[model samples]
Target: MQTKSFAALAIVALGQFIAGASANSGYAGSCTNIQIYPPDGNTNYWKIAADCKNNAGQTNLNTKINIDSCFSNSNGALVAQLNGSFHSSCTNIILTGTVLSASCRNTGGANVNTSIDTNNVIGNADGALYCFNQGNL
Candidate 1:
């Protein structure tokens, strides 16, 4: 009976460990100590955090993603309207939990693709609507 009780306690301990690990499911690792002037918002300032980088080997990686279509919904969720001219030069636009990656044809019709940080999207999203309509962002 003592052995069975010990085994149950061990199982409970393991369960608590797993629960603690999963509580930070969206933990971001790419966040660095570097600081910037603007648009440097976290995934709600904590928890998930990372950097947003433009495509590889591009002279002007600052290619602006016209996020004019993004807006806050009534439900306090982010609505990024992607379509039409937004992806006109790109294909293979894939959104992962970490990044919004894509592949696209360059000016010479060659495929040039890169991924930016999805934190920009999430941070740019209705981040102001944090918790009961009160946000520190």
Candidate 2:
């Protein structure tokens, strides 16, 4: 009788402990914001700044930054001329284009990722004019 009660209580306690552990198991990192600006008079040259929450246990930083110049046609999408993964400490970066889009991911532990969609720009230039900045990472 007493033995059976002890066994039941132990099982209940184990179950509660497991549930509590699972509730707290996940990645809790995020990027605050991504800012883009033209470095020179040329709109084709852009600089990017991204702020991230450097949560503990985070190892790698993966980023996909892009620029999309809106044109009259459907082929005016410009990707990041140069983008890749690095240490989480590498926050400041550069992306060149008239429009901007970006994604930042923290990996190697719990996983947290965020992205920014491409922005559209309207002007009196031909669709081909925007192609000057179109390229891949």
lDDT tens digits, residue span 65-109, model 2: 223222111122222221321212122333333233223333333
- Stretches of candidate 1 above 4 Å error? 1-85, 121-137
TM-score of each: 0.30, 0.24
Span of ten consecutive residues with least summed lDDT in model 1: 124-133
Tens digits of per-residue lDDT for model 1, 32-91 = 221211123532111222332323421221112222122222122223332223344544
Q: Give me the candidate number with maximum lDDT.
A: 1
TM-score of 2: 0.24
RMSD of each: 17.6, 19.7
lDDT scores in order: 0.35, 0.31
Which candidate gets the maximum TM-score versus the true structure?
Answer: 1
Off by over 4 Å in 2: 1-29, 41-44, 57-74, 80-137
